[model samples]
Target: MSYLVLARKYRPRNFGEMVGQEHVVQALTNALTQQRLHHAYLFTGTRGVGKTTVSRILAKSLNCQGADGSGGITATPCGVCQACTEIDAGRFVDYTELDAASNRGVDEVQGLLEQAVYKPVQGRFKVFMIDEVHMLTNTAFNAMLKTLEEPPEYLKFVLATTDPQKVPVTVLSRCLQFNLRPMAPETVHEHLVRVLGTEQVPAEPGALRLLARAARGSMRDALSLTDQAIAYGNGTLAEAGVRQMLGSADRGHVHRLVEALAQGDGRTVVETVEAMRDAGLSAASTLEEMTAVLQAMAVLQAVPARAAQQDAGDPDAQEAARLAALMPADETQLLYSMCLHGRAELGLAPDEYAALTMVLLRLLAFKPAAEDGATEKKTLLNPAPPAEARPPAPAPVARAEPPAVVVAPQLPEPPAPAPMPAPLAAELPPPTSAAPAVQAAGQRLPVVDAPRRPAAPTAPA
Candidate 1:
């Protein structure tokens, strides 16, 4: 009849099919296996992270009859059973899916609660699944409070919200809450590869990786982007086509930008930005791509053995490793910080490409002063004060040391000259007594003559 999107086609039907959220799955599976069923459940997380999916699976597990029609409460539901199939197709009589975002008034909530008084018609329990429950009004939340807190034994409440903080505590306390975490990049990557294989699509590994990273931990988003990438590549996904589709610069360009920054080459940085602008690529995406490379380079720099074993055949890896060697650890940290803060300023700038260019050049401005080939290298930050800041202190210190040695020999020489000049005032030259005149100022005006004559008589006596 109609083409099914990959997101819906590959939706997780059971807890076992769920990826990247084992802790929640384990707890729910054990609870179901032990028959410890809660009347109400709350699933909270960001959008596209399977809040609705888990709610449906739990609904099926509660109601599924086996293929032979005898199954009761199970963690895994047999998809062929009428109960499971209906739940999967959203046609089950007992399961009610509400979009609280659209119907958030008290009237809508009161209407849903009105049905809780009745028992299940086609399943073991009647499930009320409200997606984006946080969007409901305060009065709406108040209307559901009494019924949600103490619902009929046959009724189950499944509340899902992306923003749990907005959910009222009175309603929250009545249900068992589980938070679904975002998927890891590796997990998303592997899942994309599996999907492409099933579709008979020949996608390059690099293309899948770009999709995985671009997905930012959303499997549905990843699959959606993959569909677009496939179309962009004309049903054959290649790295070049995917890169163009995402408007990302070549990995080679990212490498060159980082390599130039590490080498403090401003011209290369400017030219690279120019090339990206000319190619009509996004400035933010270019910075985003460089951020990824800089992160990897930091990782490589942290682990040298890993750097040595980088994929020799891959040009991107080779360039990254080469940059890892060229950039010291501190500068790597600096460049990483610059890229992070620069991305935020792009919108405020008049020309985003000019902002991107300035961002790339910022690394050169912050280049570690130690990297400069100087015998006395100064740090770019925390520079030393000028040597003459304390001019008086050092001047005295330098001059005070030499006079100590000069004074020792001169102390004995001066006394001998003083007595000799007095004893031989008549035989010796007047200059012999001149040395005492230099010291006579403290004693008297004529002490040079007066004291030497008196000292000459006292010495003989």
Candidate 2:
């Protein structure tokens, strides 16, 4: 046999072997054990999260016979049985798999429906497994509705799709739908370790962790990248080799870059970018790596316990935590925003290194300057009006009067002002020896009279 690819070689044959998707497995297992089988089933999730895998497992569970050929429908199939072996090898007469991506026409759907009428050749039930069923045409879906909703007692329909939205709601409502979520990084990491162990391929835990993250919740992708890493490292996976293979920036570099950004060290940041460029690392990858680091920093800053638990396996968790402490929440958010936006700048710039340098420097540029220096710079550059231009505000006046009215009132009759008001001096009376006068505004001014001089005082004058 041609060298089996790692993905196919390690394809999960049983639900117990599948990684993640526990909710789906539990429900299916319970249904199988209770013999509460649905005529039609729909599995939805991103690629390689085990939608098709679950379908195949269900097929085997329904048809498998024990080693002595005495088994019936069961949640756990005996691999030694003819039914299980044939299904695992993809040679089962009763189990049929259709690629809707290729056979998506109405005629193809009708052809498959025709097989639904016939009974199982040997097994207790006939299984129809359709992959990428969402790719089927509207007319094809219409053709499938009747049979899918009400198949024969001995026939089962299993449909799998990465996107369930494309599947008609009418069809979706008729089937037992199970959504398989994308596997978490930690879950993917553990799965990789198991696979590598089985293959006897020595791998660094950190290397596997990086592969898991890069896979983005896809098992096939994780396996494919692991294969590449193994090849790159001559069958022994190491962090340095995997990083080189992925063209991914190292966490050490990412940490240093973030630290410099947090500390407002523009020179160091630029120098780091220069080194990355010299090493021929991708600018986009640099930004992406930094974004991941910033995201972790934010999470750590927000929930210490959660971060502690999640980062327990990470060798750099302490460094990451320390960086989180040194960086403020606001700056962390800012740097995250910059890294996200900087990814787009990579394609626009003539040289990615220059783009990266500017992107890293952007954070430093935004750092708040000292209050005194900032104020002085602002004042010197944009000085306020001189004293002559902006004279001291006129002394506070109680009521300001217009020197002259440019436009008179529009009333038909002019306002009457015949009364001659007393002068301001008359408004206030002279001070008297008996009663003193208060001259301030709004105060009562008392009348005053000079005291009469004696006759002897007049002679002396």
Candidate 3:
């Protein structure tokens, strides 16, 4: 037999086999048992979250016959029946899957609708499963609106799309919508363990953990990566090999970087980046790992009790708790923000490693004053002076003004200028009352005009 990739080979055979989608499964199961079926169903979520899988299981439930070929519709399908077996193999005539991404025109939609008029040939109900239904054009969507809103009792519609926003609201209104969320990393990890156990492949827990994190909540992606990791490791999965394949930085380097950052040690930070570069590690991955570690540190700092509850076996958690105590909460938050945003900066620089170095150094450049030995500088620059040496602050004066008018006090005229001394007066010419006043020695007196001078001048003219 040819080789089968883990993703396809381990595809969920039924709803019971599905993981991390209990909410969706429970609702569908109850609905199936109660026979409360909608004419059209819309499954929305990110890629590889089992939107199509749920649809297939639902189709099987509606068409399943018993092992003895005497069964009616059921929540659990008998996999042995022709209808269930054919649907699983994708060869069932009644279960038709259309890849809307390729055939997204009105013609294709109309052609599919033409099949709707006919009843099921080999199953209880005719299922039309359209994958990536969001890719269908507006005209195609409009053409199917009427049929989708009110389809025949024997016909069923199952639409799956990664982007539900693009799926027209008109179609959305007619169908029952269920949003399948991405699986948690822990869920993906546990599922990987089970799948690998069944495959009889030996994998380290750390390797599986790395793969789960790299999968980013996609089980299909997790399985696919496991297959690659197994191949890369020559039949067994190891943390070092998986990390190398994913280009993920070592946790040791990440912890060292965080510890260096917490200590405000720029030299250690630079040396760590150099070691990472020498090892051919990705700068982006380093920042990504740093962000993760920093986030945990921040959480631990905020909730000190979380440290006790964290996985005791996980060295990363213990290291994070140690660093969390070493760094202040505010600095932890600042570094987390920087590392989170620094991933985008890696691509903008000419050399990604150089950019990574700058990003790491940025935390030191903006280190908190208390941590950077600036607290003393702040105190020295703004020290309080002695009371006597300090200039007193000016008191605030209240301003009030009198009316705009002035009056001078009256005084009796000085007693006729107190008659000059007789001897000094005699030395001076006789003074005219209006003009002349005697002065003391070395002081000059005003001159008085002689009365006859004007007459003498007039006679000469």
Candidate 4:
């Protein structure tokens, strides 16, 4: 037998064999079991999310004969029957698959629609599986609209696309659409373990983890990478080998970069970049990993409950929680945004490693100052006047003492004082009991020779 790639070799054969996309599977399974099947079914999702796989399984479910050739339509397909075996071998006469990407023309579409008039030659129903159907031109789409909306009873139209937006809404409304979600890392990891175990291949858990993460939620991609890893390891999968093959930095390096960034250690970040360069790791991959870590941290900061419920044994989750606690929520979001945009900057810089350094250091640049409530520089509202050089305020000092006198500017002499009445003069105190005198605005009372001279003057007279 010729060598088969892992992606094809481990391709999901039936609904039961599929690992992810349980929601789509459940709906389709119920439809099949209850025989509430729709004539037109549309599957949409990214590549490797089982868009085509689901269509094939549905075909098998409808056409599979039981072990003794006595089975009617079922949710579970019996692989022993002729129809099931032929479909699995991709030689079924009634099941047709069209690659719209290559044959996206009105004539091609019209030719496909013509098959609806004929009945299934070998199976219970004829399945027209169109992959990447969104690539079909508007004219091609128009040609098949009537048939797609109302196909023959014995014919099932399965249209799959990665982008549903490109597919006309008119056509979309005619089919029962089901979206297949990308597989989770854990789900992909478990599936890789199962496949490796079945192949009797010796593999390390860490290697499988790296593969799962590298897959980015694509089971086909995950398996294909595993095949490369196994060959790279010469039949054994090791973390070190897989990491080298993927050209990603060591997990510890990513953690250290994140921790250093959270602590605002620019020196450590730069050194990490140097270390990664020395290890020959890809700069793009380093940023990629950082983006992932930062995103997880953001989620942890945003929703604590969700992060708390994450699997305890997952080191990535634990580290994310720790980082989220270490950094403020706003900082977490900032770092995440920078890392995401940094991936594009790697190519523009003079050197990618240098760009990586800047990207990591960006967080430190925008990070708030230490929250320890210690002002970096003391700023006084009114800085204490240079009190050492000058005495205390003169206003307060002057208020503490009595003013002897307040002299007015020099002026002309004032007019002489007038004589007092005799009755008022009798009420005056002795001359020895003198009171202090004050001058009016610019006038002074002049002293008149007392009447003392009057007695002497009378005697003289």
> Could you say which candidate leads in lDDT?
3
Q: What is the lDDT of residue 259 in candidate 3?
A: 85
Q: For candidate 4, lDDT tens digit of each residue in 341-398? A: 9999988999988888888777776665644865232344635567587676656444
> Against the hidden reference, what TM-scores do the models get?
0.81, 0.80, 0.83, 0.78
Candidate 2 C-alpha lDDT tens digits along 1-461? 77887888988888788888889999999999999999999999998888877887898899888878988888888888888888888999999999999999999989888998789998889999999999999999999898888889999999999889999999999899999999898898998988899999999888988899999989989998998888889989999889989999888888999888777788888888888888878788888888888888899899988654755667677777889998888889988998899889888999988888888888777765658545222233666788889867878769887565243223344354334336533544564443432244445444344444323323344
Tell me which residue pairs clash in candidate 3. Answer: none
Candidate RMSDs in order: 11.0, 13.6, 7.9, 10.4
Clashes counted in candidate 2 amount to 4
Question: What lDDT score belongs to each candidate, Candidate 1 first?
Answer: 0.85, 0.84, 0.87, 0.84
In angstroms, how far off is 102's CA in candidate 4?
A: 0.8
Better of 1 and 4 by TM-score: 1
What candidate 3 gets wrong by more than 4 Å, as runs, is 369-461
The true-versus-predicted C-alpha distance at residue 119 of model 1, in Å, is: 0.4
- What lDDT is reached at residue 128 by model 1? 97
249-305, model 1: which lDDT tens digit per residue? 788888888888877789888898888888999988888888888888889888878
Ten contiguous residues minimizing lDDT sum, candidate 1: 403-412
